[model samples]
Target: MRYSNYIGIFAGLLMIVAAVFPWISITSIDAVVTGFGSEKVTRFGMPVLMNLFMIGLTTIFFLVPKLWAKRANPFAAAINFSWALRNLLLLSTCRNGECPKTTIWLYVYFAASLILLVMSVLPDMKVIEKGKE
Candidate 1:
């Protein structure tokens, strides 16, 4: 339970919470497509998967202080960052002259992902030589 681990933990929690919220909303004719639904599950599947993976890795980062865990944290953070970017780009872009309406959750998710990325890289340990400041 170090100070460095707090950011990752908070980011992981935010991601988990964001998963339950709406991601993308598109209205086509009389039909609406949301991030979560049996019809649009494919659209949101990857984000959920990545979020869960991040949560697992962050948990392992706290529980097991192993080299593998340290290495995995960055990889997970990268994936999460990419996932957030992909979602932000996809939902914000216009397709067929119409852009999907994004919810606040999407932005929150992206922010959390970015935080996770920064936190992941902030934990690197530096070794000092003898008598070095």
Candidate 2:
């Protein structure tokens, strides 16, 4: 019931989702990525996959430690969402090099990516407070 407990639970769930969803989420991504005669998804879907893999790794690493600990594992909990963002942004950008400014879902995905990134960092709060000791 503690904040740390919640963070641990959150990180654990994120890890599981990241690990499992790539294979599942890819279907949805592949389906919707093809927005209006866009060849971009075909060109950049691999890059997006790579980002998903990294996000999955980040969550799994965060979840490795036990939940009772008051602090996060410093290295495990520190994930850079910006890295994934660049990948997602680039994947969203090059619809045949035209940069699909018309796409709203790309922005939605971007926002969701940011949220995942933030969640990725939640486990770190434990380490920041507890790991030093």
Candidate 3:
């Protein structure tokens, strides 16, 4: 399990770049951000705080070792899942909506985070199925 914490590391670094990159100076204000593929009103306009909050959580996971410990608190997974879900909700804004240049990068980062989160939470099938196999 020596290099076992890579998922959190990857998720964390991506989020850190997302949180502070471009220093907000070069970033676009009118960017579509991201959103799931849905016509519902809930799919529109996410506040900056939500995105920042995720960046913070993910950064914590990356910087804090306790969060990724084998027997650690489950809250980390939940938090990461929340972040991923939030990101997933925003994915379509990149492809389907009128997003700015930065939106694509943000979407990809979050999408990668979503995958990492999924990998973290799902029961490790190999460990669970070994005896059966």
Candidate 4:
């Protein structure tokens, strides 16, 4: 837990970088999809932006040395992880007998989100006992 904050920060950065890479390529439409933009698909409505915002908040919470910030970090991280999962499931699935080709960057994004969640859950903190101190 001593390095959780640093690790979480790194993971957040990694997620941001991963978002710029191609996540999947739809063979049927001959289009490539990335986290920030889906040129041929507009219905997704920039799902990764929410994840980026949550990760940014989580990273800030990790840097803060307040009890309340530590407590709230996990919540943001969990939301980020859930959003990553949703993206993975939706993007990799086959539709109309055509399965999109998944890329390594997609998995990397999910892994970074998961790592951020774990780091947030195990944040290093000092809690004083009401009676002891």
| Candidate order (TM-score) | 4, 1, 2, 3
Worst 10 residues of 4 by lDDT: 38-47
Candidate 3 per-residue C-alpha lDDT over 39-74 given as tens digits, one digit per residue, 9 for 90 to 100: 233334443345456545544554454524433323
TM-score of each: 0.75, 0.44, 0.42, 0.93
RMSD vs true structure, all candidates: 3.6, 7.9, 8.8, 1.6
- The candidate maximizing lDDT is 4
Cα lDDT, all candidates: 0.69, 0.43, 0.46, 0.91
Tens-place lDDT per residue, model 1, 1-133, is 2466787788878877876787666676433333333254354444466567666776677456566777778887887688778767866677788777777887888898888887876675545699877
Which residue window of length 10 is worst by lDDT in model 2?
A: 19-28
Q: Give a tens-digit lDDT track for model 4, residues 15-100.
A: 99999999999878788889997888876657699997898799889999998999999999999999999999988898889898
lDDT of 2 at 126: 35
RMSD of 1: 3.6
- Pairs that collide, model 3: 34-90, 35-90, 36-89
Query: Which pairs clash in the backbone of model 1?
Result: none
lDDT of 3 at 70: 33
**lDDT tens readout by residue for model 2, 41-98:** 4544443444455545555555566664323333333333454456455544544334
Ranking by lDDT: 4, 1, 3, 2
TM-score of 1: 0.75
RMSD of 4: 1.6
